[model samples]
Every structure is written in structure tokens, then in C-alpha cells.
Target: MVSQEKKIKVVLAQFPLETHNRGIITVAGMLRDAGMEVVLMGNARAEQIIKVAVQEFADVVGISSYCGGELALGDELLTMAEREGIRDHTVFILGGIFPPKDAPKLKEIGFSATFPPSATREEITSSIKSAIAARSLG
Candidate 1:
């Protein structure tokens, strides 16, 4: 009998005020095509995203920011996740328009990875899969 790997469950969200969503929408479709299950939450607040992540038992929590203030949003989301007790198992990733210098800051704030606009589809999917796998091992 062939054994199938469990599908990775991901919750994708954007800050409630963020209006640039085309990239995130495309990413959601890409993740789904990569055999992962994705729950896309449009214009969601940090708390809402955390609630959904918990309810969905999501392996990954992805946030997209295009209207700026990614650092603050990322920090807020991580704080909320930590408060909700899901910080240990869930992989957090950030994507969208942000200063290149902010990537390390985001990672330091607890995002597992950050993707710039130039990131390829393969890179995003592979990194997410790798992060989830690493988290499981850890």
C-alpha cells in the first residue's frame, strides 16, 4: 500500500487595512496547487487570524502586508500567536511589499520566513514545506 504524506494546513491572512491582496490571493492558489490545504482570510485582524489558525489546527500561519507597517503587524501577530499558545507548533511566514532590510527584523520577531515580491512560486512553496518539516522535527 502506498502511504500518502499528510497535507499541510495553512492559514493565510492580511492586516484588516491592507488593500493590496492580489499577491496573497495568487499565493493561496499556488499553495493549494502544491497539495497543501489553505484557508485564506481577507482583511483579517491579528486576533481573527489567530482564532482561525487555532480552529483550523493550521501547520502554517502566513501574513501578507502591502500597505506598509509590516514590522508592527508581524510583531502583533506573533504576540497574539504566543498568547494563544500556538507559537511552538505553527510556522509563521510573511510576504508582500516591505523593505529588504525588514526581513531579518521579521524573522527576529518570530516569522519563520519572509518572501519579497520577487520570490518565485517554487521558493515560497519549498520554504513553507521545509519550515513545517523542520518545526515537526524540532
Candidate 2:
């Protein structure tokens, strides 16, 4: 586990208007257990999530999309983050019910990582840590 001083601060949100929150809630628990500070912003719009990320000084911003609009949502969030000037320091990740093909598209849209429902707890935590590390290095 990381020490308190080095804990990765993450702000997690569900895509705007999305109702399937169980996956993100579970991920919040997993991240906390992994020693990262997680702020779960349930069902917030892209703008609200970006505001919270800035307020929290988040190292990572994660969105879970159970709905089919992952591409649009991801683009919107990235645009907002860029506007808020957190795009460089923040690692953006997306998860939940998206097509396998959309994963690459999401990445192209500025998500640092993408996860399907099949992603394991270890994979999620490890990927988040790695992304944070890479961001710091760059």
C-alpha cells in the first residue's frame, strides 16, 4: 500500500444521466483498498465531474459508462478537462459497457485507459497506479 502522503487522488464519476452505478461504486471500494484516495461523484454531468476534479486536485479522473454513449461522453469530459487545465496532470480512465472496438476510440479520445466489465480488481488498481506514475514522469 502507498503511504498517506503518496496516495493517488482519484475522482470517479458515472457518465451524465447514466443509471448503472454499481460498477463504479465497486471500483471506488477497490481503489480505496489499494490506498488511493477516491472521491465517488455519482451520476454527475461532465462539467460537474471536471469541477470536482479541479477542487480535489485529482491525479486521475475516471468515468464509468454503462450506457452506450461512451464515445460522446469521453470526448465531452476530455474537452472539459482541457478547458479546466487539468488535462496534462490528470489521467483519465473509462470503464463499463462499451464495445471492444470503442476502447481504442476512447483512448484516442484522451482516456488514459479503458476497462471492460471483465477487468479484475488487480488490473484496475495496477493500471491506475501505472498511469499515475507515467503521468508524473512525463
Residue ranges of candidate 2 with Cα displaced over 4 Å? 1-5
Worst 10 residues of 1 by lDDT: 1-10
Model 2 whole-model lDDT (C-alpha atoms): 0.90
Q: Score each candidate by Cα lDDT.
A: 0.92, 0.90
Residue pairs with backbone atoms closer than 3 Å in model 1 (clashes): none
Tens-digit lDDT track of model 1 for 33-91: 88899999988999999999999999999988887888987889999999999999999
RMSD each, Å: 1.4, 1.4
The 10-residue segment with the lowest total lDDT in model 2: 1-10
